[model samples]
Target: MERDRGRYVPGGRESAHQADYLELFFDLVLVFALNGLVNRIVPALTTDDLNVRWAALFQTVVLALPLLWLWTTTGHITSRFDPRRRLIQLVVLISALGLLIMGTSLPYAFSGRGLAFALPYVLLQAGRPLLFIFTLPVGDAVRALYLRSAIWFAGSAVLWIGGALTTEWRRVVLWTSAVAVDLIGARLNWPVRGLARLPASAWAVERGRHLPERYQQLLLIALGETVLALGISYTNEPATTETTIGLLTAYLTTVLLWRVYYHRSGEMLGEALDSVRGRNNLGRITGAAHIVMVFGIVATAIGYKLVQQHALDRPFPLWVVVILGGPALFLWGRIRLERVVFDRLSRRRVVAIVALAVLMVPLAFTSALVAAIAASVVLFGVAAADARRSAGRPPEAPAPPA
Candidate 1:
């Protein structure tokens, strides 16, 4: 494998690097962005106005999907290119700055900062790939892939910028349409009017560990957000018995989420990818799984904050939704990921998902604290099932096709 000047060269396993420090530095900004998202949605769950709450919830998804998409794009860049190169470093640093601006604008995205959010995002999404297109040799397959990607991003930019210039639901519709374009375009391989789809080899990951490591880092980042929110929420309040109990419940829930995540399947993604028969769709499946799990973690953080802020208050329906829904969503994502790794459905997670749904109605009448505990218990059961399955057996090797 000959090294290109700035592009990734497929190399021996020994030559491939682990995730670089700069990549981790970039993820710090993602932490702030995740926090902004959690903060953005908390108010919506607490509000009494049905229309306002529903609108804010829609806004939350509208805002969140793009941010997660941006992160996924960044991961692909590092996976496809040489992250240690100066040009790659510059792309990541600029992205961190863009994320910072996006995070700052989030609280006001629907009100006054739509452009503030849209501008940097558009520049990053549409511009970064254009940069890559010029950097690679004209005949390079990777360059061709990026060419298709840039076309899609450039087309979607119209809607993003248009949404930014508008107001209210108009903005939401345009922005949502823009995200659909970006996401669905990528899913379909970013087809253009005059171009054929890039061959599957064009999407091959040269460095196997890099993409999996980045995904794992993101999972930790999401879990880290939950820990930070729990700690901060606890420090700000009087440590009464109820608050203390709520803190413990939230902390346990966070641990259980982490536990359920890393059990056999999560720990074996790299092996699964290595063993998979085809690589083209593995990254896409894994990326979608992590996105859903991260969403769940962010929502869980918001729910715990609500518990800390109003521990004794009667749980609102929305609060209960957040409380149980987060873990349920996490389990749902985990089940998909398990199939990717093991080629098997996760009955335990399925049962947990159903259990959470059943508990939601009863939990709605209880305190947020009770709802939090029930969610944690459900997660614990999943983790326990994982432990039991692994007991007295050899470590689970990935069964994913090559």
Candidate 2:
């Protein structure tokens, strides 16, 4: 079969070019900005004022949806389109601006000023898909994917716009429904004109390094944001020796988590993904692993906040359990993907689980900050050791050329 050069160029060596570090750096800036805004707003939700609490929750979900969408969309586009292109850079710039607007509008969205937030967000949300649709010379199959994506974006925009017009709970419901529609459409394999069919070729040989690097970088930014939140919280509170140690422990935990992930697992997953021959499984695994990783990170952030709030006033054993458990869950989730232990328990994973269980006891007795950080490190350390042991063995050659 002849390769279509115009739509699909082949023979690009899957070299491990260093990830576009600059792109990631810019993304981190946006992430930190947004995180700062969220840290400011979320605490109000727990305040004694019921109105503030309700308003905070409303604004948080409203802002969070667009932020999540932007990250996911940019990561997807960057994976497929060459970020070095002028057009792509412009789209990224617009998205960044949209993020800035979204960040600024968070405190105001629930006070019937949502349109101020929603309009820019819609622009950011719509711009990337539209740009990619017109610019990237993708084949019919991939174009179909974009079209479906566009429909989802349109639906989401409608809900977002509607939410801005009215502060009623119904608008929130509508926006949520729109998000659901997009999610379900993708899950159900709903087709769009010109791009419903999944192209095995587009993804099969496409560079895995690019996408995985984006994933890793985003995770790092999320961790950094959490640490920033911890710092701010610690500074505002009375600084005691315990608080100081807790703060340092929180930072160490974040560092150890990074070391374990990058050192032990990231490269292995990248190599495994690159070696795969088709796009479907690789995309699914990549997507799933990423979700689990981010979920864990977000959970850790929440845990960090909880630890900071409770460190001086209350015993936070449960919060401690959560912070430590968050990363353990993340690591275990990754291990499940790596070892293909979908339905059955693998020996190594069982051992990892047992290690986690052992850590839980200490976690129950320590400060939330200490326990959470210690647990994350322990989980990462176990996984790293396991990965190293596996790496040392020689590969068995293909059996005598069959």
Candidate 3:
């Protein structure tokens, strides 16, 4: 396997080790897409009928997946290429503008404006690689990878745009096909004709920091939006006791969720990724795991808003999916990450997930505040147990490349 080596350039920051300004600015733009997604879902989800709420939530997830994947794939480009380059920065700007329009159209995406949402997605995902192919110099291996990726995105775009032009159930089927194709390409690393398999030498995180840092920034955005949802909930309604307790409970839950992952889980995964820099399988597992983790955070954000809106002591039955299921999904992701990173299963973590699942039936009858608080306590238990387990182990280093 190749080591941490790069070509030298005189008088350039190409060798600089941290994220640059243009990348940070681009990250800021993507959050508009995230905020727009939650804004659309929560109101639809809060309807009085159970079946309607379920349908709304189901559709919300479907719409949000492609948006998330678009941003993730864009991140892949910025992470791999030199965004500091003049041409690369221009492409990044163009993609961000397309995404902003897509974000604004989220509420109407499934209604009348499906094509509005679809076109920007197609342009951003399919056009990005096409832009790079012509601008990047010849004989570069990374450029060849760009060609392979463009092929994947172009094929997926056909399904995406076709789905957008349809309505109702057929739209769902076609969009699913598009997402499935994209996921399969990623899962298999888009192994088309003669592109070098990656984390190419350019994409490796030498200090084991860049890749995780980018993901962590997104995680921060997720957590910040959770807190924002709590604020929005509080503002929209009267500040009575139920509202106060619900907000407090959600605030605590967000903090614990942050502690559970960022405290130990993220650092360990970053180091593990560094260990197997050029090995795509380990990196894919870790990246896929974080995607699940982000979804859990997004789910929890919606639950917090619902918690505030419910009548006191009346059951918030959907708490089963959001309050309980969110943490469960996160722990599931964490367990997968740790198994690969530490080479051992954390039994307490697994037990905590099962316990949360068992508690869901009872939680469905409880007040939202009680439900949020209960899940928070359970996560604390898992984090505590993992801390104890770590006390007897060697201080972490990336597992040496096998």
Residue-pair clashes per prediction, in order, are 5, 3, 0
lDDT of each: 0.85, 0.60, 0.72
Clash list (residue pairs), candidate 3: none
Those runs of model 2 whose alpha carbons end farther than 4 Å from true positions after fitting are: 1-18, 37-65, 136-139, 188-190, 193-205, 315-325, 336-402
Name the runs in model 1 displaced over 4 angstroms: 1-14, 200-204
What TM-score against the true fold does each predicted structure earn?
0.95, 0.76, 0.88
Order candidates by TM-score, high to low: 1, 3, 2
Q: Write the per-residue lDDT of candidate 1 for residues 1-402, one digit (tens) a residue.
A: 344776544333344457889989889999998888887877777778888776777889899998888888887787776776667788999999999999999999987999989999999998988887777766677778889988988999999999999987899999999999998888888888887665633235555678898899999999998888888888998899989999999989998999999998898888888876567777777888999999899889988899998888898888888889999999889988998898889999999999999999988888989889889989999999889988999997798745
Write the residue-wise lDDT of candidate 3 on 88-199 in tens digits.
6776788778778888888888778888888988888778777656655555555666677789989988988888888867777887788888888766657776556644
- For model 3, state the Cα shift of residue 274 in Å: 2.3
Return the top candidate by lDDT.
1
Candidate 2, residues 65-178: lDDT per residue as tens digits?
Answer: 556656766666656656665565666667777777766766666566677777876776656556545544555555556656667667778887887787656666766676
lDDT for model 2: 0.60
Q: Candidate 1: how many backbone clashes? A: 5
RMSD of each: 2.4, 5.6, 4.3
